[model samples]
Target chain A: MNKTIFLLMIFLSISAFMLVGCEFGKYPLILDSSVTSGAIRVDLNLPLPVQVTQTTSVNISELRNVTGESVDSMKFYNLTLLIDNNTSPNDAGITGTISVNDNALVTLTNVNISEFQTERSIFDKDLAGKGFQYHAGGVLFLLNALKTQSPDILNVTVVAGTNASSLHFDLKVKLYGQIFANTN
Target chain B: MTRKRSILFTIMSVVCLLTVLTLQVRAQNPLEDAIKQLTSENAKGYLQPFVTAFGANMNSGLYHSADISQLGFTLRLDLIAMGTVIGDAEKKYKATNPYDGSEVETATIFGEQGAIVEPIPGVQYQFQNGQVKTSFIPFFLPQLTIGDVFGTQAIIRYVPIPEVNNVPKVTLFGIGARHCVSQYIPAVPVDLSASIFYQSLEVGNLFEAKTFSLGAQVSKSFAILTVYGGLQYESMSMDVNYTYTGNIPGITVPDANVSLNLDGKNQFRGTAGVDISLALLHIFADINIGSATVISGGVGFGF
Candidate 1:
């Protein structure tokens, strides 16, 4: 009986430790290693960048009758837009435009991935953060931009602080038409 | 005056009980009821159902006492997926479809995962968009449960879950301040340990007795013959309408009355079984006639 018991014990012990002794289930879980999420400490403070492009998809010709006057929005739909790049290159590219009569407005939306990765990184690290909203010039522009034959959506971007980095967030938009008369 | 005397005597007792009952019921962020059966409590037998029933009754009853809209509604969305395991293996079981990774696995919440804990079969649901759903009776607390989840039903008290050998079972349920202990105790490092618990109870009726239970379990796991024992505190209180003989001036005949009870506990139990893991599935099923009388099988899971 003693010899048989010994053999049984030996067999069971060998099986229990077959692999490098890792418990498959029922044991408290412990991570074997750790993982980090963002970039190491880094900073860049420079003049922000700006760009403007005509989105042919946003048609303004459909707003012919809403202005209460014989006016056209399609005519001013592609005016030369002027903008301010006040953000650091490491962050967003802030830009906006004015009307042909210098009465048009320039809007600046929050900067997103396109704004932050303005330049490729030598050391890759995620820069997305809870977006900053200083109101800046965009909101003011939308409410007051005068009549124009051309209207455009200037892609806005920003770095953190007045000129911060690791700034990434996007804007969601739907185009709506309203009456506007532009005089050169 | 005599009738008034009895009412004054039991009011505090009843209030105390109701208070304790309320605290215990909401203490745990308990999961879906279906997961309860897979637990293994050594001797917490024959009173699990009463505990749950009392819990259900009290939970709904308390809501009844509070502000509940006469008309309410529910919008339910359900999802299920059939998944497989991937990981390293010991000897082999069934060579699964794409069987390369580590085989660390556990039972799925619904029938979408694993064996013994497999789905009831053939049940499917429709793909629904975010649809506006409205109804009267905004909610039915009962439907919020799987009617006897985890086999924490009337039968668990008398039935013996199978599949394991000789290892004692430990079942548990804690209410109010004690629930943290349930999660804490099992997590305590021990050589070998297992515990299970269930409760379904009904209590505080104007007529029939209100029933409730407090159960506990403890066990030590070993290579062979793991055994255990348990204790349950249970009770039922009912308001009995008895005739009150009036003897005061200007009063005539007898009137029906309402009575309540305080103080209840009628339970203690235990059991043991062998440890078995199949295809990385931790289950305790009856090796013989397949299924047992009531909840004879159980499975363990990792969060």
Candidate 2:
């Protein structure tokens, strides 16, 4: 009986060592709900909605696809996002980010962003309509369509107060059946 | 029809039909083939359709699976699983990594994004200190590519006219290479690659004099054209018997003493070409205005 107890103590000590090692394990970044995974190349942009106070219209075309590389087409669907307070009108700060899969920073600051998508479907091609607006103070929020299966997502933030408040959103792109051309 | 003629014709037709059927079956089996079908067919165009239509995703999927031979053995297995098949191993493979030394690596992506940036009130970005920097518009290019048969060709031979008549032997060789040309025009940089190739063409016997060749080729691309050139020096060495008149019955002369330079009499070649990327497909053409002139047109996929 004494020998069995001694063996149990030895096993417990080994388990404790493993648990401590795991505590210091290398998991610098953890994948959470806010992160997106799959990214594709698509030519789409979001023009800044009307600035509340500023006379100059905010340009939304700055947010680009991965690496800001020029994409002729892309498809994405099912996305979650967060935006800070910096996209407000009174503040000239970093642009609000549009999340694709996970990696963000899709746009730098102060640039005209426009979105255009030529979606491929089983039968015909449709154009995706996009828009953006200032949420409250300076935060800019946006959504666009990538393809029939893929939708564009944005993580919006307004850097207006003493500290920025992060906002979360889950977005899906819904396309209208008839083609809408810019008649002008 | 006469009985004799009909009988003979029936036998002959049966043989021809069998041969045609066999060839057709083999053509559908990709592993029974080299990349030549993929590469050479590319030269004739339609590579994009072949890829998109034939579940070329299988090729990419297999590549991302377990590691494969340079000849894509893993892909061949996947093709087999997909109901497409390969026949005859030895005749099919020109060169394959028999050892399967390389291991497969799995790629992972980010699961979620953690933090985000926001705007500030009454704060200026300083607008780069009111500096207006203007320069030329920058350009960009895509990465990741794989291909075989940078280039290749054949030869015929005859003995020095002793035991054999002009009915000499023929030698053949399969040539291939992996080419990577990284042109960063935005960075104004050019990375080129050059390699030496050895190939032989033979109809039957190795005893027949073998033509030895050492060839070098270099490839580069500008905005308009991609240029490549190489020299393959082929020569025949001889074992000569001399009549010194000494009459030594069993005395042999020498083994491979001198190499005959076949530069002018043998071959040299050069080429200039261009490839225009057309969204779904790409069109490429090359013209060789040199010793061994050949003009080839090719179409393939960029993805």
Candidate 3:
């Protein structure tokens, strides 16, 4: 009788304890964050026949607002640039270098202002390292700056190739991406 | 047995059971990542399915049959396994992309990854993927039932686990009673009973849940085979506490402490099952239909 009781206790204990704190499923999640450089404008005055260029800077200080801490990784997905020509003519040639955190990322080679005069104006269909004229080193520098720096900024400089004419336009850049996180 | 010795035996058995059960370790951050990714407002829809499924499972398998003894005392122990099915409707939800002010159809915590949407052409944003991608949510527990003081049975289920690794401690406690109604009737072909149960579950300080149910059951026995069915009215509610690490626009708070009180969707359920008795061993299986469908089974040893 003693042996039978002891064996019964052992069986019952093992059966009950095995079900406690037993994890049933694996859950993996991917989060997302949206980023944008608000409306920025470049203005220049023309008093001589020589061309003029001006730089406009915008502060990107709220990246951490969306990409919370303890995230596994984040990557840029689709990026686009929009321009509104306020004072410059449609036929004018615009050239400028875009920089992030004081590092030169891309230099536009006489991009025509007419391409942005349509009802829907968006540049760079392939911004995820495809068909975009961005230096690899510069792109990496920008991503690193956004990830590490608290107060990062993007600088846009526009130069008008047409002489004897003033230049003025508003520039905006939007970034969208995925953030990988695990719920373990 | 003397009353004092019986009470001492019960306490020793419960203590031994709890000590052995705490040896298992579980790793699950149930609400930590939800707050980080979905924030306060959106976390509700993302986690609603889990609350409903858990509530349905807790309300199921309360009893395999309603045949309490009318005379001498009997004791039984059961290990119940229950699962709640996840329907297609619980997979998706509509949420606003706060950055661009666009409505996007996104996945819930039990769904597939959401589709990437472009609020404005050339600018796209994606939603969070599902945390659990399964068709059913399962739960298991051990239950004890003792009976026959004037045709009534008492039921208890308790499991308390300490914090292990980084995961929090978990505790579940339930108490219930069943009364046989057929004992007062004459020439009844089926055994009839009514029961009421209340259960509470806590996961550290992050989550707390409470459920209550009142049910009526009927069963017919043929030698070693018994068939049972029941109808229950139940309700469940949960309170969640977490730190909101993600910021929302026009919201001045940072790292805000968020608390949400949510109610489960399952209100009424119908259950049907069969139980087979073999001397000292009993095995049973059942299915419940409610706001969600749940399947339950158990193995028990009884006298």
Candidate 4:
């Protein structure tokens, strides 16, 4: 009787110990989201062919609604520029610049207006010397603002080179990146 | 008195050690975070290793000895703890970037943080976070065995683990019966038995799994120690349900309900183990080799 009682007590103790404060392992958290700067209309509707620049303000506050939560840090991977040509006759030539918060990050030169749709990575050779780090920093700076639920507006200035045929097109910037947080 | 005191001390030491070891692991709410932001396609790769390893662990530790008493009343209970080793290949899988349909190699649930891949210059994709950063999957459950009438025994197992991190409670239940095969063969030197078992586990509405095993075992007793070996065919499957909260550019629907049915890689296993009986106390350990390697051990008290 004594042995049985002792064994029962031992089992109960082990069960209680196993029940309380058993922890599961924690893993890193990675969240991904895509943000886009809607089409920035660049209408070179001038009497004489001349260079034109258009500035649009874009804020990624909508990312909060997309990710459904705040994140600690973010890094952008792909940046694609989709050019929707609205004019009948395509432009002779086209070039442009992309900036974050007025800080130039990308510069396009001698771009094929006929094939204007191209994707540029942040580390693209074309964006090497053009304040690449600053562009990344500025974008992330705005993105991380979602952490505080207060996103800052990013300025995108597009410089269209001299074009003929009254070049009318819309330039849209699409960005894909990952958000990092430790929700463990 | 001295022998009894020594046994009591040993049992207490084991209990304390297990308690301390189990307490070292801390609970975090990674299950929800691991799959919540992932599309069904990506979630499958991230969680496949867990499914396989978990099933392997569940299918192990079925028996420690093949000896069955002949027409007698005997009862036993065991606290079986099992772990299935995760292979290097299982730690990672090929994941597809939902935006571009490009394949990338990323971490599984048992791996390190996922890989960030740039299929092209601008489109960077990162897979979901790995849930458990370990080399093996582990499980702990209690089993009860009662026998014998006409050289047959029945086994049952049930365990309910309390919820942590807002995840639902995890429950496991199993039933099996073993029949002595050597009883019909007169003067058999070794005890032989054939057994079949079925088990199911559930974790709230998020996960559900089932395991089936059929096998034959043989054993020989030496005083208080019994050596045993078995060959078993086992299978397991898990179903996972989660909401697709990821922002894949082409997915037109939001909050799409995603369900995955996954199977374990292990189909057969060979096991070897020894059981030591001291009065009414029993201790056993075993290792099983199959598609995955699994180790199990437990302590029990019975007559």
Clash counts for the predictions, in order: 82, 42, 0, 7
Of candidates 3 and 1, the better by TM-score = 3
Give the best candidate by TM-score.
4
Q: What lDDT is obtained when candidate 4 is compared to the true structure?
A: 0.70
- Candidate 3 - CAPRI tier? incorrect
Q: Which stretches of candidate 4 lie over 4 Å from their true place?
A: A1-27, A35-58, A61-70, A79-151, A155-175, B1-28, B97-100, B119-125, B162-167, B250-255
The CAPRI category of model 1 is incorrect
List, residue by residue over A84-166, the lDDT tens digit for candidate 3.
75677555555556665566666565566555443221224323232235555556654554455434566655444443255
* Model 3 residue A110 CA deviation in Å: 28
What would the TM-score be for candidate 4 when compared with the true structure? 0.72
Give the clashing pairs for model 4.
A23-B26, A23-B27, A24-B26, A24-B27, A78-B122, A78-B123, A121-B121
Which scores greater on DockQ, model 1 or model 4? Answer: 4
TM-score of predicted chain A against the true chain A, for each candidate? 0.21, 0.18, 0.60, 0.64
Model 1: residues >4 Å from true position, as ranges? A1-184, B1-216, B222-228, B231-254, B260-267, B270-303
* DockQ metric, candidate 3: 0.14
Go through the candidates in order and give each one's C-alpha lDDT: 0.24, 0.23, 0.67, 0.70
Chain B TM (all candidates): 0.24, 0.27, 0.87, 0.87
Interface RMSD of each: 31.3, 35.6, 7.6, 6.6
lDDT of each residue in B1-303, candidate 4, tens digit only:
367775875576456544433342233234665576777777778777777777888888878788887798869777777777777888888887654566888887777767776544433566775666566566677788999988889999886666655545667889999989998886989999999999999876778999999999999999999999999999999998877666655444544788888888889999999999888788788999998899887777676
Query: What C-alpha root-mean-square deviation, in Å, does candidate 3 show against the real structure?
Result: 8.3
